[model samples]
Target chain A: MREVFHQSLEDVQSRLVEIAELVTVAIERATKAFGTSDVTLAEEVIEADQVIDDKAIELDELAIQILARQQPVARDLRIVVAALRVSASLERMGDIAEHIAQLTRMRFPERAIPKGLKSTFTKMGEIDVQVANLLTEILRTEDLALVEKLRTLDDQLDDLHLSVFEKVLSENWQGEAGATVDATLASRYHERFADHALSVAKKVAYLATGEWTPDTDSIAVIVAADLAAVRENADGAEA
Target chain B: MREVFHQSLEDVQSRLVEIAELVTVAIERATKAFGTSDVTLAEEVIEADQVIDDKAIELDELAIQILARQQPVARDLRIVVAALRVSASLERMGDIAEHIAQLTRMRFPERAIPKGLKSTFTKMGEIDVQVANLLTEILRTEDLALVEKLRTLDDQLDDLHLSVFEKVLSENWQGEAGATVDATLASRYHERFADHALSVAKKVAYLATGEWTPDTDSIAVIVAADLAAVRENADGAEA
Candidate 1:
């Protein structure tokens, strides 16, 4: 019975990694579509999200079955619960990717790229890649220190997001509707992507520390304050 | 043992409802501060959010303890998990309310109110109240059908949000930077509040159906398409 339970545990972990891989592709495809204005790629990302969703449901059922049958204890139980949350974070990440894709599709053909925002957008894209990499690391290594690092990495994304808005507003380019919309949406997508990544980090942190301090508000505050400062600076310039 | 376990479950549910109430008050306070430029109320919301966060952590630990000690099964397990998610959502909702307060405090004292946007802002406020009500309903009754109805109600909030952007853009009342910032932040808060409520609904649905659909994209498409139609209709008036 113990051997069978261990095998089931192994199966659950492998399936979770599979779902994570699907989510990674979804993020990559969605970010690529946003950067390149590739509507077809964006649509593909949107369609493929359903697969990740399906996998999450399947994994949840599997975990519940294992819990019911084997009744995992202590650390093993934590692993099962962590699997549930990781799947949830991956699913939310997939949803954010779909949101980005939808935004791309909405502003298509004309390709409303924000002016002087390319580097900022590219930086956000890099941050997103970092998040995906960290998720993979968490899954494979279960490194508590690395998971702790994600909180700071999320802060970095917050800082980049501020720069994106500041660069847009400070240039006195407010009249360009398309550019403004693109910048706003891009920043939102990046922020949410980082948030979902942080959710994964928090799960790992909980597993390691057995204490849950999600730190969502701190990240939100950092991002909000940065944006507020930019807007204030813009107001001063206008005055 | 079972009686003690059931009583703990009841205690957890009561705390969850209390947290929900606090969040609802926070949302109201924050919105009022936004409308009236009341910094004190904004500060009050910010301070209250910490208590909400503490409650969330407490409830999570309590649920985990119950699960560890009681070894609940099937329906009981679902209830515990749903309680965890509800606590998380309430905490996130509190964060958003605090975010709105922060934006209000930062942008106020300048006191630039948008002339024609008050009605729209008020409408967003109403939507927020509806979201709060839905959350209360979810907690009080746990009715699956009512939870499903929240998706449709979320569609209404999305409509109000698009209308906000259209009104701001059409009027070209872009000079009042503070008001524009306020409107933008207000709209964002409303949208996020609805999103979190939808998340709670999804959790409830999952608990009841034992099936998770991950239909965020489908719902987004519906909302986006509806917004597009509204925009098209508004454009026709200009033409």
Candidate 2:
């Protein structure tokens, strides 16, 4: 029974890594699509999201079955429970990618990157793809060091996200309402993609570190802080 | 052992209800604060979110303990697992409220609700509060009927969300980039609050109804469809 349970735990881990890989691909393609107005590539990301969703559901079922049959206790139980959460977060990351793709498709033949903020969004997308890759590595290897790297990447994404707002809200900005809206939503999607990856990285870190922290440092705090800092800077600039 | 396990499950249920009640209050205050630009009320919501977070963590610990001790299987195990997911969604609902409060506070001395969209945001806020209340009721009573009502309210919120985008993207929109950003983020927050409640409501409904669906009809699909429909209408207007 002990050996069987260990094997099941391995299964959960591999499956998580698998789903993370799929999310990585989804974000990579979605970001590329958004940058180039490649509607075909965007459509691929939109369609492939279902596979990620299906894999997450399968993983969840496996976790539930392990609980029902193996009845893992103590740390083993926490591992299974955390798999459920990691699966949920990975699934959300896929959805964020799909949302970015949808944004690309919605503005097909018209650049979704907006007129003046193209380079800003391009950087955000590249960072998001990097974050997804790092997340997959963490899930696969359980390298806790990657967790810090992931957080740093997420912070960079947050700064770029802020820069987006700064660009749009500046007096010299000349984009129309559609451009502003696209930039706002697209920047948000890119930032949230990294945020979810960071969250999953934290969970993996907890599993490796045995800290059992329950997401006290949530995305809301980071978002609020980012916004507050940007607003203060904007105020200072005007002064 | 059986009796103790049953008792533990009841404790989980009641604790879920308790957390849901707190979420209801958070959203109620948050939406109110947003509409009024009441910085103090926003501060109250922000400060109280930590309590909600702490409760969620406590609930998670309890659930983990139940899994460790009771080792429930089949439907019983799924119940505890569902509690964890529901707790997460409720906690996220609280975070969304905090986000709205942050927006309110961020724009203090200047109204957060952009001009000409006051009535729309008011309706969205009211529906979000209603969704939170119904979600709490569903958690408390397992009343599947309320789930339908919750979906209806979510639909209303979705329409309002799309309408905000429409108004912002239209030719007549006169709000500056700051107002546009605020409206975009605030509307997204309001819409997501309801979405989280609807998600929790679905899990409760599944538990009560014995259907094992695993979020196949995700928020991604709904959002994609919403954006598609709105863009179609916008394109038609241009044509």
Best candidate according to DockQ: 2
Model 1, A141-182: lDDT tens digits are 678878767767777878887776676667456534434555
When summed lDDT is taken over every stretch of 10 residues in candidate 2 chain A, the lowest stretch is A212-221
Q: Model 1: how far is A237 from its true place, Å? A: 2.6
Span of 10 residues, lowest total lDDT, candidate 2 chain B = B212-221
lDDT of 1: 0.76
The clash count for each model shown is 0, 0
With a 3 Å backbone cut-off (N, CA, C), the pairs that clash in candidate 1 are none
Candidate 2 lDDT over B1-239, as tens digits, reads 89999999999999999999999899999999999989999999999999999999999999999998888987899899999999999988898999899888888888989999999999999998888888888988898888889989988888888889889877778998888888888999999888788788878877877885566545556666676677667677878
The C-alpha interface RMSD of every prediction is 2.6, 2.1
- Alpha-carbon shift of residue B114 in model 2 (angstroms): 0.2
Error of 1 at A56 (Å): 1.5
What is residue B237's positional error in candidate 2, in angstroms?
5.3
Query: Model 2: how many Å of interface RMSD?
Result: 2.1
